[model samples]
Target: MKKYKLILFSTLSLLITPVYANDNAEQLFNERCAACHSINDNSHITLRERLQEKAPTLYYAGNKFNRAWLQTWLAAPSKIRPGGYSFFNNVNVTDEGDVIDESKITTHIAVNSTLAALLTDYLMAQTPKSDLIALEKVTLGKINRSLGSKDFNKFKGCGSCHQDEEGYGGVSGPQLYESIQRLQPEFIASYTRNPEAWDPKTLMPNRHLNDNSIKKLLNYLNVISQ
Candidate 1:
């Protein structure tokens, strides 16, 4: 009889453990991440609003980021945006135009291992309902480097905000030349399909390119990353 009672107690404890952990994660995210990021959509916003914002929205972060990457980034935060979130306040345009003064880039907040894991768990659960990314089903396409370069620079005007080469492109966005190293190919495809899906208040405009174009862009990213 005592053995049965012990078994029941152990089972109950096991069941309760994950619930408690999930609760802790939610509470921690609310306290830490919510302060800087909005878990809601704010993507279709103006430049003034973007300039005033403190952090990027996490409304679709689960769809946007891989769990492993998020965990690693949380523990050892690195620079993503060249000019920082509030670019108007942090970056200054020179005689040469918007050059990134490294000193003005805002540092990311770092978390300890435990907090990082908890935060990552909570963030990974924030999946947006979208069919844009069929991760396992989608295959990468080949890039014509020359044409891709033209699209990235002139046709799409992505160069106005993002960087492609060492000394080129704009300073308002994270450097794209290293995107293949930093992000999953599927993530790149999904983000290109709809930037608003992951970041509602993103300054990036959705160009509505076909899947082939997105795949080519991703291929170009891979080539550049190497």
Candidate 2:
């Protein structure tokens, strides 16, 4: 009888531990992250609110980021966008051109390894736009580096905002060289197709790229990321 009671207790503990951990993670996120990063669905966000947002919305983080990359990034956060999340707040008009005021750019809050893992696990479950991600069909194909570079820099003009290489291109947007590692492939394709659908007030313009163009861009991104 005692042995059976012990076995039941062990089984009950195993079932309850996951729920407890998940609850703890949720509480931690609410305390440590809710002030800056929003975990709620922000589809109805106004332009004024978006302009005032301190960080990117994480409601679709599961669909947007690679799990490994998100986990690693949380442990030791680095500057992805050189001009910060709201670029207008950090730009300084200079004689040469509009330069990013590095002083205004603040570092992301880093978490310890244990907390990072817990937060990442919780954040990675917030996939509200799984349907949107599903609609994107990403296929890796070869693209000529010279032609791709020409299209990205001159014709498409992505270089005006994003960097394809370190210390090169514009600084207003996140660096694209590491995007393949940082973002999910489906997210990359979907965002490229329609940035406004994902981020209502994003500075990225709607290029209305066709399927072939988007695929070519994805190929280019993969190449550069490698």
Candidate 3:
């Protein structure tokens, strides 16, 4: 399977012309990603825009994603959101609550390693404007597994819907442990501050958490993921 994927990736490389080989990542982002993504902070986005959004904003993607994961994901697109950005759009009403219409779902646009690398670098630089999440202070608030586990499950009650371990926790939300590898510290910190600021329709609640609490949570996520 690995060999097959490699072959496919290599085949994809042949599609791009050498004329645009020296293409700027920022230019590539504007031309390729802008249609489906917002590269701005989106502080002024309206409720209608929120409901109509097709993909997540890239304004703070750098703060939210691991560089390695970004590179891999860009090169090989996969479905991260089981329910998708908007389940109502992609799902059909059946006897079941709602079943995703796999055929109507759009896949991510893939690029070769060169473009992916440059794009990843560009994407990583798109950090949030907020200076509230002080890296130095955040680093100091690191928590241990015992404390983190309790906070994750009991205090936050996050385990009610999110996967805790291999077979534990609820399946409604993404696995927090896996998220540790995929997300960046600053993004989590910013999102926790106000989930609606990024995505108005996001399921994540505005926990009204303080900077210190978020920093500790970030530390806990980092520790457990490692």
- Best-matching candidate per lDDT: 2
Candidates ranked, most accurate by lDDT first: 2, 1, 3
Show pairs that collide, candidate 2: none
lDDT of 2 by residue, 1-226 (tens): 9999999999977754443354698887876788998999787888899899988899889999999999999999988987888888898868977688889988888887888889889988998889899999897776888899888999999999998988788887899989989999999999989998788878899999999999989899988888
Q: Candidate 1 or 3, higher lDDT? A: 1
User: What ranking of all candidate models by TM-score puts the best one first?
Assistant: 2, 1, 3
Q: Going through the candidates in order, what is the number of backbone clashes in each?
A: 4, 0, 1
Q: Highest TM-score among the candidates is held by which one?
A: 2
Regions of model 1 farther than 4 Å from truth: 1-22, 43-50, 101-103, 134-137, 141-151, 196-201
Q: Which ten residues in a row have the lowest lDDT in candidate 1?
A: 129-138
Candidates in order: C-alpha RMSD to true structure: 9.9, 9.4, 7.7
* TM-score of each predicted structure versus truth: 0.75, 0.87, 0.69
C-alpha displacement of 217 in model 3, angstroms?
Answer: 3.9
Q: Model 2, stretches more than 4 Å misplaced?
A: 1-22
Indicate whether candidate 2 or candidate 3 has the larger lDDT.
2
lDDT of 2: 0.87
